[model samples]
Target: MNPSAWPAPAAAVANTLLVNPTIASRASARFPLALLNLAAALDRNGASRIIDGNLDRGFIDTALDALAQTRFDALGISVMGGPQVAPAIALSRAVRERFPQLPIVWGGYFPTLYPDTALNADYVDYAIRGQGERTLPELIAALRGEGPPPAQIQGLSWKLDGAPVHNPDRDFSSDDAPPLLPYAKLGDPRRYLAPTFLGRRTAVHQAALGCRFRCTFCGVAAMFGGATALPAAQRLARELGYLKHGLGADSVQFFDHNFFDREADMIPLLEVMARLELPWWCYARADALLNLSPATWTLVRKSRLRMAYIGAESPNGAMLKEIRKGTRPDQTLEVAELCRRHGVIPELSFMVAPPHDTEAATEQTFEFIREIKRINPQSEIIVYIYTPLPEASRHRKDRGKRAAAPLLDLRGEPVVFPDTPEQWTQQRWVDYACHADAPWLSDDLRRRIRDFVTVLRCRYPTVQDLRSPRWAKRGLSAMAAWRYRLRRYDRPWELDLADRLVRLRRPQASGL
Candidate 1:
């Protein structure tokens, strides 16, 4: 139920049950969707179908095996692209190798940005380039019983007897429809999490979709063409009623690009969520809702709004401008202060070292995280390494200019992007370093990174998890930059980084 975008497709789906790759070597897989959304989309009109299996590593092979021999009608692959491209393309290849007639479809953040490249994969029968919330069902109908053979559908690219075909973009069909999933459904907690804990139940919810802000890192704006918020009560009633009456979900996690982008609508929504009594967390830019009122906080507390992840993106002022993060360090602190005052936990989504990050900037961000971590045990420090986001940045435009794309190994490879060969080796080192679990520190500049994290944990009692910072939250570029640099040394800089990173090796702490 992305507030801004249309709900999941209205067309009776072709029995397609979208599934995340089940723990494909840990990182290859994605977490589950809000059960409500999945249930809503699991419809029967064109054909009952699911949209997420392509991303699941465990069942992908099985799904493909079924696709090859089974009499299935439609196929969809959703990948965020970049490193995910290899698996996505490989899966499509697997599908083609197994079943030649099963009309395939591709969607997700990647295809939306590079429709042509997605078409390049011979295995892809059809590439869904935009919001498939509405388009997928329609495209399935156009294909299931045979209407258009991939040539006429909008927002798609497909093959016509081995040749690529492109189509004009179409507006989302479910633009005005209700959410595909009923919020009152409350989602099956087990289905969303491997463990029934306070953390795992906190799966993502797109009460609204798209973003009003044009932060360069987010794919929502580029993929969805910017902000679109569903009416507040219209959307709130679903989850509010559910949490209060249907299921007692204490915490809610938001997947929206910016929860506060539509403050006017949010205020009323908060009122409803508060009345319902739930806890929730969502991503936000610094003070995006600067005028957030106490009622907002009370409702937030009532609705289980305990945490908010804030993105500083860069500690360096200039980089923030270059990337258009739309917020600064001062504003970021403001956000933390506001959350603290309101008794909401705050996590810093920080960039350690990215394309524009410097050792100095990294130091500052580390200190910032430590400072916040000192204040709240619930405070989590997210560290990210930058990587090319096909749709998020100018990645697609830059891809062709890059020397070459690396080949993928399906048997199994680490589930991530390695911008360079050195990166591959470095990640290996860090992986091993984590196993070593030493308290050692380096005399070099990276020593500060080690020092900062060690101190931050002590300062913040609520910071229960003592491990490597969360990766995706840190900014992918940041992770890569520091990982590449830190791992470059012949010797392990410090055992703590690896020790800290042990958490990453755990089930994806990134999302549900």
Candidate 2:
């Protein structure tokens, strides 16, 4: 239907109900920035409300109740492709059953990576790929009979005659000066803030959108297609000031895909952070931190940069290059030492157990992690199995070009990816998405990885574990020292017993 032929806004202002399906525990939950941004855009021409499942355990019922009380034009569910897929499916099914007429749209990494699969389910009506700030409002307008038909909406995938129809991908929006996120929509925003290693009452913000790097294995690359935009300095100051002075957030966590971009582009933002000095944590690339000038380093220090999560994916330079990670192993080591000198904890993550040379690669990475710890004992280590994205899951621009070598299972069978959201919710696929396990990892290798991780973490207890008593950490460190030094990472049943009693937090699973 032509937009001109549709009813006027006076007849109905499109109202949307946005939901972020449960992805984290209540204590680990941060502000739902994606939904907030979408809400801001929706409010520009219509009305929208947010439901973060992380904080609300009974979110499915709450969403239904909200829909019952209000005339919501559509329901937008934000889904990621791991454990979140299950809750998202449940919520989508519940909403579909109750509000049969209301349109249900799925967005975020899950749909962006597998739009067809997302739309395969009977519950999900439309899948919004890429940035939804623009596509969402436009989709809602079209659904409300106020705009063009579904085929004309870019970044939208919908079913036509029971078949998924994917429109041309949308260009990355210039979010240099986005509208202030409607945090007020989430009543009592203080509930979103939580204590972290950075400071008490740490709030989360995203100063940049997307990431420039196109690492073959990274979900960010598939979502953004190597596009990124940093916020304006004024916008950063305004938002940070409000987060600090207005909401009493003692610290901030910048959830930018890659926080430290080019040095020249980062100086202004760093200056604003320095002025605020609100202790911050962020995701950074090893090359970016290593290339920063001394002056820029001073600003970073003055800004109270507490921790930087660097993806040191592998110890082998060949594997790093094969994955197009952009940074090398030496750079990872250098950044560890550099972060140590700058008083920033380098939370380094390594992806071990590749499809080929699974055991040898895993052993190499363990040794490399030891070298990093020797350089800086304060360096926090995160280990994950190397699970590359399926060729079909790559962004359209990247698909079929430099495709990943075919994956093989232990029996030399081809590794097949799930073709539906329900399949993705299966334990094996969920493990693949989370980078926790893979099809090719043998039982012995998996146990070895677990044992090594247990010993390594016990030896160097992460400072991020605020719940575990310091005395327990010290005692665990003392107990694990011999195993760590001797490289005897066999099943440490005693350490396992003690760890069960202590219940140390896994920072990789629940970020600060």
Candidate 3:
């Protein structure tokens, strides 16, 4: 058993269990840093009997077993803001049935956004609205009968006299950022697998929190607001070194909503990162790429920014504006060109069959994708049907009377947009592109895009399967058969050219 935080739990009042509910996808299960952060906070407040129930490691029974054996004052569940809610609800029910007296607390993006729904549920006893780092420790103190009254705790939701009571909101900018998660307390980080970088041991760490842009379909802004900030550059560099040298990670994946939002923070971080000699990848907006200076671009390349996952929602300027992407079609193309020039792979993604999707919009999307294919056949293109997020739905005025799931995974969770044609529901666009060979584009372009996704899913099944070992194995088997049948397109010469295109190198720095 893992030892307590310092001075062990004095009694049941100071014990806590941090549960990471099973997400349906393997891709979603990285290091549970969010839960670990809360654990560290709870530890500082004298809760040492902390049990980590990470379901991603195995079955629900394992987590339940941990809960059964450990003596916990409060049970906390961290859930994503989408389909994972279903699993979290089920886990809460099971826990309630077994330990009826223990208080059940829910924290995370889903609970933060939908506190009312989470609190009203039969199982959840408390909901932490914004950041749980501070709120969680305060709640633990109250549970120990040592801190302020429960009603005075900010950003908390719980029952009072059998009625739900919501405390006043906390100013996120003013709230103290929690210290680094107790990484050592959590078991070996290597067991936390990320299949994308097959050879290198990768760890997920956030450079910053919140987002600058408020796209119609994103919940980051809703949860954390537009203003984003990061720790001091030297501190960030130290953290990266710890992950690389301390945690045995060879690569780092930045979970920041947008890493390059502020030039002051990004450049210094990249400069320090260059010395660390670690390859990194992050999510960024196209506009951020366009706004970067050539020198800054050079510095980024020196820092080994291997790939950028950009949200190029649509190719049409009007649709881009409608979705509040704040990027023009030409600018996106320019961003791609710059990534190529700087020796970086810009993995561009697009949304299809959305509420605003029309025949003309479809044509624009195809045209945009076709152009990118011509420019960089090595680059990746991801297409998804527009799944409406709860907060985004409110901002979308033109979406005529469409019902959307509260939370969902864009890859699966079948949802039909309000404006999608009857024939195009359930991702029929992909079928038409792969099989029908729609009249608008040549068969070659459609074939290229289809093959891109097929090859990618095979190479990184975790993205497709999320984290289900069963599904990952099944996908690998299917990919083998697929390769055998499509031998014509898998020729050495063609594949060599594709690799050359995909792995573009940057111009060497003058001094280096």
Candidate 4:
């Protein structure tokens, strides 16, 4: 491809359009933080616009109208692996059909995990893997015949003569003194502030990037390659102050892949939060929480931390080590008690069913969850099937190292993963991505897990469900108390029927 053959750079600054095709309901939808960050970077030298499909039911047509009206150099789509893939495909195909010449770039977790699969489609002109803050601007400039050719761009996958060509992966960026995300691009930013258990107008922010641990089953590990970076204290203070004062956000939900890092490094940020005194929720590790110094814990309490979501992936210590999840089961139990004492709810999520020892592992996890509930009745439990990423989907740095064992279905046949975006739209594949179901799960085992979950949730209706009435929750709890006490979690037909009437919200689905 010759640079000279491409169109000349426009006299005015280039404008790029970003679309977030997440298929979540409006009530559950939070801010599209990924697009906002990209838009902020693009605004430095060029302008960018955001179209959030989660809030806009007619986003496809809206995006088409925008493209037809405005002169956009490129259309960047933020996609995730599961339900978002179908909408992304629809939007990409629609834009390509309507405007035949515009460049379509796909980014976010979907492209980062499967770059070749993303580039395999005729609609996707480029797939920006890893961080797109820097890659996107460079690619946009290159498309305008003003920068290096496509082959030179790092962390990019492009088709060369109808063949996918992936360049070397780019190192993670140092998030030192990063600019504030352009929330204004989303049109009244207040609309993104949702009502969660934290507060009435809860805003989501990511003060840090990536996770240091390389948990094999985690998409974050595959996307970030075990690298993590925290924001400067001043940057966090500025952002939080703006969100509170400028935007009227009463609470915050930190979407950091891992919020709590080293104790010494976290003090300044904790101090900032303590001063703000905003009720907050964050994703934390059991080990990290247990290791926090007494002084830091004081700061955490002063900050009014309402809840901490910890991934206690499994009760089996050996399984934890196998997945490279650095935390131990003991730490999980300890954190439950610790959170109880600190007046913070410990929302612990566990991966119940594993490919190997499927039944035993799941049953053990169920027992472990019961023990946690006994230790701290306020502890919240979330269960997910243990679904490991395909070897090919892993980060290049960790792909061949400590490769996963071959996975087998219940029929003893090797489990195969989808190769293209369209295939991922299948119901089974979507369920797999969401960790709701797995290929190795038998019909009996699936029903058992569902029945157990029904009983467990009914016994202790989650505090996060603001929609469900108080009388309904208490009635469900009284009805489920006997089953939960007797451990009769099999075939919970009565609880299931009652749940349908109450329509309780699953916190796992919304991540609130």
- The positional error of residue 502 in candidate 1, measured at the CA in angstroms, is 8.4
RMSD of each candidate relative to the true structure? 9.9, 3.1, 9.6, 2.6
**RMSD over all Cα atoms, model 1:** 9.9
Write out the backbone clash pairs for model 2.
none
Q: Write the per-residue lDDT of candidate 3 for residues 1-512, one digit (tens) a residue.
A: 43222223447446777777665345335777777777777787566333344424453555567666666667788876443565677778887776676678998876666666677677888988778888888887787678896799998988876677889866566235454667765566666645444225767888677776766566665566555777677778778878877777777778787888767667888898788877777888888888888788888988888778888888777777766778888877888887887877777877655543334565467567657756764455666545445442232222332333333223444343222112222244323322322323334444544454445434333222223455544545354445534433333343334434333211110000
Global fold similarity of model 2 (TM-score): 0.97
Cα lDDT tens digits for candidate 4, 88-157:
9999999888777789999999899888888888999999999998899999889877899888999999
Across residues 300-325, which tens digit of lDDT does each residue of candidate 2 receive? 99999999999999999988888889
How much lDDT does candidate 2 score? 0.90
Q: Name every residue pair that clashes in candidate 4.
A: none
TM-score of 1: 0.70
Q: Write the per-residue lDDT of candidate 1 for residues 265-296, one digit (tens) a residue.
A: 77777776666555566777666645666666
Which wins on lDDT, candidate 1 or candidate 4?
Answer: 4
